[model samples]
Target chain A: MKQWFLGIGLITVFFSQTVQAEIVFVTLEKDNALAIVDPIAGKLLKTIDIGQRPRGIILSPDYKYLYIATSDDDTVKIFDAETFVEVGQLPSGEDPETFALNPKGDRLYISNEDDNLVTVIDIPNKTEIAQIKVGVEPEGIAVSTDNKWVISASETTNMIHWIDVATNKIVDNTLVDPRPRAANFTADNEQLWVTSEIAGTLMILDVKTRQITKKIRLDIPGVSADKIQPVGVVIDKQRRWGYVAIGPANRVAVINAQTLELEKFLLVGQRVWNLAFSADQKRLYTTNGRSNDISIIDLENHKVTKSIGVGRFPWGIVSKP
Target chain B: MISRFFMNRFLLKIILVLLLGHTALTYAESIQVIKIAYITQEKKIPAALSNLDAFVQQKGLIGAEIAIVDNNTTGQFTQQSYELKKIIVPVSADVVEIFKQQVGEDISLIVSNLPRTQLMSLVNLDLAKEMLFFDATTTDDELRNKQCQDNILHMLPSRAMRADALAQYMMKKSWNKWFLVMGMMPADQAYAKAIKRAAKRFGIKIVAEKQWTHTYDARRTAQSDVPVFTQGVDYDVLVVADEQGLFGEYFEYRSWIPRPVVGTQGLVPTSWHRTHEQWGAVQIQNRFKAKVGRWMGEQDYGAYLAVRAIGEAAVRTKSRQMKMIKDYLLGSDFALQGYKGNPLSFRAWNGQLRQPVLLAAARSLVAVAPVEGFLHPKTELDTLGFDQSESACNNLNKETLPVKPLLKGTYDSENANSYQQIIQQIINKIKQNF
Candidate 1:
């Protein structure tokens, strides 16, 4: 096992230089809409009509088109980034709850929860390249930077299947925690962080060894441990700081990447679900499902500066320049 | 001035180190074995229903064992070893004396799976004053209201909670009329009374009520006598309460009119069912099946929850003292995860557990109750059971029923409006229930 040594003495601090103009897109699962927000002004611009049960949102690498997985309709709807108009749609598998884009941005890997398969689609042709079988109720999908592997987290099986992209086959399955919701790769692509919503813990796996290096337990002193469920994770590459959205605790935990220590927890709205970072990485936006709003966190100041109301049940978020 | 600043900072660091050391030493000294006991009657399978009940042999004891294993997992981290002693008394044995002998002085927490009278006897003892008894089996509402004890905390949903859960869903569907039919047993009659209370509470009408007086064998005469007995009822749904599994299952398709059966029959309200597979329940179900060689039943889940509650309390409070744990268990901060979609907590008013009751069919879950519009000030789960505002148990200790602390500071108009709306909803619910 690879042990992470805490670089406590040599902490490097970075300051936000200038505010970047960015538009934040949030998927409202129940409303079947996406609200566009101006992060710099901390205001919601408008909600655009979308398909049924829209959950995961992402942009192509070139920022030309946006892709959204509409779970109820079982389709990935594509919209023009500049025009904000519906461009086309791709046939996603049954109940496509979440998905991830490859590094080169030509393929999309989506989790079909009902079918227990990951449907890989070719972006240009909008055709499924393969459907690889996995554990039951797969919800989270993450692609490696080098595009050599894709990891899918199964909620029922309580395991993460590492799929070889070249062969479209599960190479190894590693069990982590109960009810894993999402997975993300570190900046250097050497570590994988998977969040377990039910266990309320984050397991960091060493990519090379395929072994969990650390299990970070998020327990706020005064809050109930059962309510502090870790969901979405975003790590800053410049400062090696990780931010985790704790579900019902309504707070974000900041972890020092070097030490893997929970440094601080900043309170936000009720039942915070997912998170996104602005273009310049100076601001972080969190979707609060119960409060029907989004909280803006000033990363440099480590404070929630504002909360802007949006549609009902705001689910996931993404930011594009 | 620079030398003095450095020397003062060094002294402050030394002082902080000394305080930390002192705190660690105190924690180490305070750590002790958290002893728990499971007191219950041996497995009693009725001869009539032995072949029909799949989980007759493996019930409460296996669930308690699973919970002990789960508690020890967390206990290892807190430097507390959890020790459990199982005391199973036979049908002819004296339960009170055996429970007392097994629970000797050291055990401060207990999980009990006794019937109503035996449980009352256990709680009336002087030895129970310092112990926390988790009632894991009985669903009798009287234990929660009329004869409630401060030392006993309920782990299972009460009779009213289950009835209210079914009524809420029925109301959501706008099924306004019900026909009630119950067996001759006392348990069936008690459940029928609970359903009638739910009908009054939810603004629904009980179109007709009757008792099943047939002593004919269910297997021999279910098809012959059920249709004739259920003939002449003009109702939207039929609610049957046959607790001993006599003829409730036969009324689904054998009813004179082809209506749905709800209460204890076709669509049943329960805590844990074999068909429930949501909210990470499949993991626990699989785990229990692997360990016990059968599906987990309602009593088993209750026992599992009892042991887990003790472990969770110990780990969170970082102490094994019974007083601290007892206080925290009833406080606003105690929330346990029982594979439901949300956190399950005990009500301060009656010690009844607040949980989402599942309306399940035999093969799949139909829906969960305390449906969309049934609201509460604190949580939606409060709508299912007896709320604190109008409960019968008023003599509970004030310290145990601490007023829930508000999360945010001063409320704005939006917050105030939502609070008012919640109050109005609760008032309407109370009026309907009464």
Candidate 2:
């Protein structure tokens, strides 16, 4: 009777896992469009005209609205998550490339790359509340889950700035490797993962003290060291794996989160830029900017199951349940 | 007793506010001032084949100015400030007095827009011992090699780096046969020598080599004359060494075999160009255009890097001393963002800034080198210029104590025209002897 029960449970879990994710949205930089795909069915549902140079994409906490950073337009466009219709706009300062939305979904911090300022916006009011001055060429930005500190990683300055959420001022700074491309905070808010594109290394900083806990040198056999540029970084909430998209190397480094070590390299599309995880975290989606597609990684088996062609130069991705 | 105690408390509060205000004022005044000197000789730029190309009278100085603005912006946050002192002299002027003048004023950092001869003169000046000089203009390889000084750091890529960059792109395309065309200018001859060196290093064959002897303006006549000039060689590409904008532009679409041209013209290899828009370069390019009403050229970009490097080193080390700044810059920890897809650092063997050279056409960037498959154990950038083993310059990492004490001096900018007469006589005598 127990064997029979286990067999039935296996079938149920398989089907449930198949339907874990509903849809995935990818922003195309060159084509200026958003590709909607059904990850379970592995189908490109449709594509809609997005905006000029759509790069950074995020969803509201409730998943009712979609926020896209149209970099060339110098504004972040808001859309109805279900209808895929433009709803509003946020006043992102000049040349917004990447941004972070607070866990509360009330405040949004935009990285004004050229201006070297993090412009904060009240999402509901669609108004600029504060613009915190940071380092030069600030790109990577992340707000802690508790919404206490917002971290801005400056590319040229090689420094990470800690912005207090309550005050919207830079409270502290930590020096990192050259050309830090992205930053990701763990769900528990204990660790922060930063990627250095030029150094080809991933730095894990202790969030409490802002001290770099570990530095993982990203490398792949047969791939030139210069091509192992670490860009987008994401960590599993289960603390199993931390995946970093190695740009131009065309591989996602699957790091062992528990051991805090590099485990394996999962081959992906060309110029793999950003990554997004499904709501249930069953699958991972990576936008390959050069290949113009998204590589879907089945997290359970640590395999790239499929590569779905998107629009031209897919730069950003976000998956929905 | 209560009234007296309240009066004393009010007085104390007033005094406390005044003390706090005084400290703030003093802090503002005490911000570290990093003074820099920009020296450029006003040399005559060769007239372009057409009016399409721009010629800036103030080439590297504008870039330094823009960088000063950039430095001051970062300074506001770092609690530091920057000052630029420019000294523009005529092409024939002796720079010794100005060099002494700059060093006397405690300007330990200097940006040089001078050519090799003028730059070497400054490098040899007795007062230049304790100062750091950034060569922003010249691409002379000799400065990074045989003539290298411990204090001189080059912002411009050597001619060898540019040639190697172009050669790499050509190698990638399988265009191995290069036809070499030489010009008479000393700069052009130096460029050709570097090209020959690159061809040998990369194992590419030079199908034929010819010197550009046509002296007349080829603007209108290039249509008929270029085909004849380029007729014989069945080469994959024409590599011209016209640094003075001579006949290099005429080879485009005018080649006998319809081959493409590369080198100083056509698809040129450069440190920075107006058309380069990758690796977050567009941000700086846009900012430059907004500040100065023209596209930033190679020397301008070089000058910009020089000032920014000083600013960066100052912020990193938090020191105003020249020796400390120089040590930090040459150390392993110094990495600068040059918007070239790599973190630039100076080579300890040669004071040259190791960078990726851009192969660009008129409209867009073709590719960046050291291209794929070119490997170096230390860094791929070492593939471009003189490697540590190949370079003769070794004083970069060693301590260079001040050779002579600086003396205060006042300057006369004029009366240096006779200096050229002496060099002219020497050249004439050498020509007669040869």
Candidate 3:
């Protein structure tokens, strides 16, 4: 009952400075809810009970719907963005940890971390499209901006499986660093960026050949090698810089996208997991699972400006204009 | 009590495909099918803690079946397939002769769940020259020490590894002083020796040692008798060495000082447990149950690791030859995930796989060990088992190569800004108790 009153009190405090506010969506892994915050207001607006063990969260291209991988529930729970109503579920194969939405937002690609398969679900019809087999313990799924290629990075196999989007068939495999965690293509769909957790490095690949072009080794001045686990990878829309969430090192590595060199590490909260660019591409938000907060970074200056405490184990994060 | 057996071989021809089997047809790619043989000598099931022997489902070979399904799902993308052939030798048959005749040139990979004597002789046979063996059942330290062979890899944690894992956790919990209870069986004696080795290695002191010689049924009078059995020199925890489920289960709650019981039973250290659900372990647990319709046992998990490790090696090297796969697995590059937080790898000094042992009770996971502060220069996993410097095998050369730090950066040991492990423990305790 005390927590219930605290939730309502936070909502009213968030209502005072709602001017020019952009809403941010954060999935609370331990609280089993979705926390909505007004980044401009620097306060949590409200939180809705989402689902069980919600982790991977994303908004559709048009920002009409929200998809969350409610892992324990074994379904990707979809919510209507505006109304916050439970819409339906995508047939996420068991233990869906991470997923990707195509640029068209009509197709959703989800990695079944248990089944070692990628499940594709059509958005409009709300039906299963296909289940494409990948590698063992597959995670960090992404579809190219062109929607022509979808890559699944298998942590154990350490290979990125390239699937032709049209046929939903794996066409090729590229060997990578040990325990590859996440992969993404450039905004132009020309270069592929990948993060290796154990190797503590970010790999960039040429899309034409699917071969590694540069392997940027991350080095924090005083941090131990084992503590520098790199996980999520994100680059701004302009392709000016790239940031990799260095897990446990509690920092986001800034890399000059052009030269592909490690610039510096921006310190954040403890166990910083995933990263998301603001809708305007001017700021970045990081989810620190251990700290139960999201650190806001002013991308213009590469500085951690503020941190807002959210629900327990605050995991996946995204933003709306 | 050897009974005449009739069944000779069980073959599983799994050609799994999804969605009308059209994925395979559309790809029109060459699928490489790798054959693996599971050879085991038939043995009697040991007594369990519970009295429902009839209710427990047989789970020896089911773990390999689950692995085949998992391997095939990944193989669908890599154009590689896996097929398993099982042969459980009965008392009436000659195990070596059957293995030499049946598992021919076609199948070079084999996983065995056999006794120490049988496994020792089996891996030493001339027929084992070309093939690689995966020992999934036996935990005898001799196989990892004196009887170690190049062709065979021990997938299960050796008795020493389990003891070390427990000692690490006990040290982490500040349960440094221990009262030891030894059981009657030979295996129990071997376990007791391993526990002593662990205590000395981890700086833990044993305060008292006693022999469990009572043979009467004490289940009903556990509360009355356990206190007397556990009484002697004040200790932080009672560590039992009952390997055959004799009387260790009764010590958890009924100890003389209301202390926690640990070791082979009670809060035991294991490679896998049903109650372990962290680090995506729930995925494999649920998948195993969904397929086998039963709980995955410890031995079952060992077999699962064997099959999946081979699959990982094969797919990574893209080869079916035993030489390539063996070299890749023993090499420093091999990292197989056993659903533990860290990637599982093989120890260079011995073939035992280095993994974090799960410390669990009957219904909950207590902690994962190679605990937080037990530091090793190479990898934290090496701290769990016999390191390269402590290896006793003559056949294996002790390679003490230091891993090149990924970056030339090092934080001050005392002031690292990392995930606070103490906070994690508090969080885990809250979740566990609630």
> Which candidate gets the maximum TM-score versus the true structure?
2
Which candidate ranks first by lDDT, i.e. highest?
A: 2
Output the better candidate (1/3) by TM-score. Answer: 3
Each candidate: how many clashes? 2, 0, 2
**Ten residues in sequence with the least summed lDDT for candidate 1 chain A:** A10-19
TM-score of chain B of each: 0.85, 0.84, 0.82
Clashing pairs in 1: B201-B432, B201-B433
Q: Per-residue lDDT tens digits of candidate 3, residues A1-321?
A: 999999999887776545345789999999999999878767887899988999999999988899999999999998998888999988888878899998888899999887788999998898888998787789899999888999999875678999999999988888788778888888988899999887778999999998888998786876655577888899877788999999889999999988888888899998999999888888899999999999999999999999999989999999987
Candidate achieving higher TM-score, 1 or 2: 2
Q: Local distance difference test, per candidate? A: 0.81, 0.85, 0.82
Off by over 4 Å in 1: A1-230, A235-321, B1-31, B398-434
Docking class of 2: acceptable
- Predicted candidate 2 versus true structure: per-residue lDDT over B168-245, tens digit per residue: 889999999999998988888999999999999999999899988886487555888788888977989999999978
Clashing pairs in model 3? A222-B410, A222-B411
At residue A265, candidate 3 shows an lDDT of: 89
Tens-place lDDT per residue, model 2, A1-321, is 999999999988886676554889999999899999888878788999988999999999999999999999999999999999999898999978899999989999999987889999998898999998887789999999988889999887778899999998888787788789999999889999999988789999999899788999997888877688899999999778899999899999999998998889999999999999999898899999888899999999999999999879999899878
The docking category that best describes candidate 1 is: incorrect
In the range B1-434, model 1's lDDT, one tens digit per residue, is 99997886676567555654554455464444778898888756674633555636547888888777666544433456778898889878999989877788777788998888898899889998878889999999888887888888899999899999999999998987999999898999989989999999899999988898876476656788878888987888999998878767777888899899998888999999999885668767867898867899999999988887787666555556677677667887676767776667788778888888999998989888767778776678888867787578764554554423222222212123334555566556645865
TM-score of each: 0.59, 0.87, 0.84
Q: For residues B53-96, could you state the per-residue lDDT of candidate 3 as single tens digits?
A: 44333455888888887778667666788999998888678888
